[model samples]
Target: MHAWAMGAAVLSVIASGAKAEEVVLSPSSAWVLDYGDHRCRMTRAFGEGPTRTAFMLEQTQPSDTFSWTVAGPLVDRFGKGKVQVQFAPAFDGFEIDHDASLRVAEFGTAVASVTHEAPPPTLISRTAKPRLRSEPDALSDGTARAARLRLLNPEHGRSIARLTLTKGGESVSLSFGSLEAPFKAMNACMDDLLVSWGMDPAELREATTAARWINSVPLVGKIQEFYPAKALEEGAEADYRLRVVVGANGRVSRCHMILLSRGSDFAQRVCDIMRREARFEPGRNAAGEPKPAFFSTKISYRVY
Candidate 1:
């Protein structure tokens, strides 16, 4: 091997195998899969004690993408601001690029999370029918991207994942052992979750569309209305996850929330905002029939 190639190989080994200053944690707990009214989460902790790192992966529907959140003292390694999160886990042959939200507690612990989504640039594969005819708007950009993302589902024999959190020259990496089994459990939980929501799992797999937000431009401004007074007063920060049910009429029927930290006031305010202003283009099933679906996301508030 050339001098440079050998050097690079040695560096890889050092980064993955051992690095004292860098926090590299391995699984210290079993996966806990939770099926909630709005989402499914698979969680596992690495290392031990108060400083141990905890990871949570959540999914709300049958989709290739999922949300990943990590917490604990491991979070203290990065700055309180946005962290460069690179999930290059081979995520089943697909990659994810998005900004991760970071929160540092008053006591100095922190948490970071981000969701994976395939961009609109996903093109048809070689297997696509070359001569198939369809309406110009039938296969929209979003539709094609969803189809492509579905192929990256971790349940499809995805290997172990190493998620790296970076800030300038400093970085910390966490490795999640073979995720195939945990993801399978999460998928099963999701199937039941659909049933609890009165949705047919099989039919949803063939859905022609997922709920789309309408007039969401003002959403951020509206959420800003809350200001999360209690949290700010206590000098605490939090991020809340939510799922809103969209009726066949495309209006938000109800909203549910799960807190990442203590902030009930903020959560309540967000639900109120969603109920009053959230509108959507309802999802449709394979038979072109309107279906009730959910839109899930997370929101954070900063006092400054």
Candidate 2:
């Protein structure tokens, strides 16, 4: 799990520019994941004339985990953009769901956006292995690092990530170790970085935002199916989302839903399954404070 490979794996996904409308201006993409946790956030945006278009995904919460991808044409694609997304709970982990999309048309100063959608099933892992590729560049005034990380379907070996890192005039070709175990690759990179700074992973895990992962099994499953533009009506199967917090005791302490299907029973079922199977390891904050952090996930219902 070298830094070069890891960074490549994680960045590949972002580099795979989804087919955005031509009207898009200064379009950008972002991916964020919680280490060892099943939650991830992805956002994309572009500008039109007076409006903009945006797509956001937030997977994993205290109660469940799910994912959705959507796009739309908007009036302007600039300034601040807002997006809404949806998915299913971890219990309802087997189903197709519908998500939302937003668009805008302007170029402002904001650089990032928050989104909610279920993450890819393969990305959900207890450890991450991110590989980064770094190259040196020379400019008239100084030198810099250029990098890219591959982000993609780990099981299928598809390149889904491409990350770029630049210092001064040179960019670091940062990437994940491989297209496989994106989560693990990231973990390895983070660990290496901490160690390089003469710090321990445990020390950082303890003080910063932390989560006590119980069970700690690698849920290496593939996405069996994907439903596009399908909506749940009444008992006709529902859509839900959940976020879980594994405490130091190795058990689920909190389960929250960012979205739910048509029934309360759906939400309850999601919580029940997670509580029965989740695990954890005691965590610490940046200041070496022992506490339980949060890991969010999403789930959807399917005929499975």
Candidate 3:
């Protein structure tokens, strides 16, 4: 696809939302993650208390050099967490293991750590499943052309290539195939290598489906019950995440807390109320059908 088309695809993935309870407020700043930068928002809720927090970083290089920025409520200790990051050059995934060091300064004390594990390996074959049909890598004139580059790892049984899909003006990249075939065996394999990089169609579908449910489901109107808590008070807030079921009838069928911030009373209270009151618009399938889907939400307690 053209550069604009690719930018649009990336933009679509960034715009996602989950309903927030009375105690939780959405971030005014857009959560932007570039190839090098990363951010995470965590929340916690208990009884009638709720709190939300955010962690931010701007990475200069995938291998090294990054600036860390943290905001939201203060906490006593950090907890277990996992993070995934995408690498560039449009390869299937990142080649080097990314180890992160977190430094926290609180209450006149500074604490840093490199205990978290490195970013996981992104094996291309792990995502390949049912492959797509291949035809001549043609341009608008409908002529076959030579392939420029190919990604092949016989050891892992995965390969893809870049071919001139269209003529010079409208050329695009397409990704296909999981198993390793002679690069020449596939007519447009070279073209695939040139344009499109390694991608996991199945993983893309699964992640997108789950993300759609979270974004489309409406959790604003059904708030059956609600109350405010002090855990969200400037210096005393927290962050948290929750897994919820958006029923076909546009209501939250069930919800469970996923992550909780230490001493975050505000997060807990907001979560309880959300579980009781959140509503969904329900989701439709390709046939214009409505179906129950899984969704998730994150909340943070921040000072005004």
Ranking by TM-score: 1, 2, 3
What TM-score do all the candidates reach, one by one? 0.60, 0.32, 0.30
RMSD of each: 12.4, 17.5, 22.6
Ranking by lDDT: 1, 2, 3
Clashes of each: 0, 147, 37
The runs of at least 3 residues in candidate 2 whose Cα sits more than 4 Å from the true structure, single-residue gaps closed, are 1-21, 24-52, 55-70, 74-235, 238-241, 260-265, 272-281, 284-290
Q: Across residues 29-123, which tens digit of lDDT does each residue of candidate 2 receive? A: 33333332333443444333343434333333211112333333222232233322111111111222212222223332222222223233221
Worst 10 contiguous positions by lDDT, candidate 3: 4-13
What is candidate 2's CA lDDT for residue 46? 32
How well does candidate 1 score on lDDT at residue 10?
Answer: 9
Query: What TM-score does structure 3 among the candidates reach?
Result: 0.30
lDDT per residue (tens digit) for residues 1-304 in model 3 = 1110011111111111232111222232233333211112111111111223333332211111122333223222222222222211233321122122333342211112121233221111111222211111201121111111112334333432311112112211212222233212221222232122232222222221121322222332112122243433334544444445555565666555533334345335445655666554454444444455434444433333
- Model 3: number of backbone collisions: 37
TM-score: model 2 vs. ground truth? 0.32
lDDT of each: 0.57, 0.34, 0.28
